[model samples]
Target: MLKFFRSIRQRLFKQKKFKNYILYAIGEILLVMIGILLALQVNNWNEHRKSKGTLKSTLKTISSDLKRDTIRAGYLIEIIELNQENSKAVIDRKVTIENFTTYPRTRSLVTIYQPFDIQTKGYDILKRISEQQENEKDSLFADLTQFYSLFIPNIQKSNERLEKVVIGNLEEFQEFPWFVDWSQGNTTEEMIAYFAISEDYRKKVAAYNVLAYGNHLQLIKGYKENAKHVLERIEKRLEED
Candidate 1:
């Protein structure tokens, strides 16, 4: 194409048609500019396509992480509920000395401490990608930041507080003969007597377990909702692509 344009300009120049030559030169310049613009537009489109592909993969991984989080949260919530129920039975005198000797699982439940686990590795990847692509600043990124950075940390902190309360309550009666013997699969009459004698500690444990259960329930609800919103946003974006 360049050779054809050069040949035309040479012929026009040889003919001494200066005006026509100038017009031909201008047309050639315009064609070159148009070609360059087209090439650049194609490159931009390619880059945009690659970016969308990457975004889709990242979103899929994040969705997987969120699903795992929901499952984990649900499991932890069940454990908390069981612990809470056990504590309530003891606190409300529902489990008397007779039944306490029979049901060893109820006694075991009081001594268990299960902590909430947060999933963040997928979010970490998303954060890194968002940071590298400075132009990708939108509501999706904002929502992701809030969910992974703020919301998750808050839930973890609440879990930590719950742990401290439950552990502190346990420590108060850790040295008791009943506590030690009960831990060793010996729920004897003496252990029951000791448990009944420690009414104040039992109340504290029960109260803390209730508080932990409530906190966990709220956290799980928030996590599920946030995951749902994020999944919706990701699916919508993918569909638009």
Candidate 2:
């Protein structure tokens, strides 16, 4: 193509058609510029499409993560609420052996600890992207940042406070002479009697309520609601996209 244009330019120059040659040269340059602009536009369109696809996929993954978190949060909330009630009963001296069958939650409430379960795999990837692009101001990005960084961490912190109490007490429980039947999962008579009238047992159960269970239960409940709200926000953002 260059050769063909060169031949035409030579013919025009030899014939002394300066005016026509200048016009043709200008037209050729314009065509090249237009072609380059069109190619750049297409490349940009492809990049935009690829970016949108990645964003959609990541949001979906985060949505799934939120669902898993909410489900686990629901279960934990139930146990914690039971713990709250059981703790109260023990502190009030209402957990007698005869009534022990009715309030069997003391054993588990003191011995078992559930960690805060949250998934941040998708959020972590998206967060890095947001930071690299300086897109923290974007509403969706900000929402995600708050959910993962602030909300989730608070839940973890609260649960950890309670978990330390539950787990720390669990190891110490074995040292109790009355807890010999712990391995068998049987609520021994001595254990029931300790819970029934022991001031130390009441204090321990009160400490459980004050340290973590009482507040942690509410946090888990609120977290489940926030998780759902964030899930809704993600869906809305995806729809807008």
The predictions' CA RMSDs to the true structure, in order, are 3.4, 2.3
Q: Model 1 over residues 1-241: C-alpha lDDT tens digits?
A: 7688789999999999999999988988898899999999999999989877887787778878888887887787777776676667767767777667554446554456566677777778778878778634577877887778767777878778767775775686587767777656676676676555457646665667666766666777778777887888878876887
lDDT by residue for model 2 (1-241), tens: 9999999999988999999999989998998999999999999999889877877898998999989989898888777776788788888787877787787676665666687767888898797677656665678878777767876777778767877787788778779886668657776678778767678778887877775565777777777888888899899988888
Best by TM-score: 2
Clashing pairs in 1: none
Q: What is the Cα-based lDDT of residue 239 in candidate 1?
A: 80
Error of 2 at 3 (Å): 3.9
**lDDT minimum window of 10 residues, candidate 1:** 102-111
Of candidate 2, the 10-residue stretch with the lowest lDDT total is 104-113
Give model 2's TM-score versus the native structure.
0.87
- For residue 49, what is the lDDT in candidate 2? 91
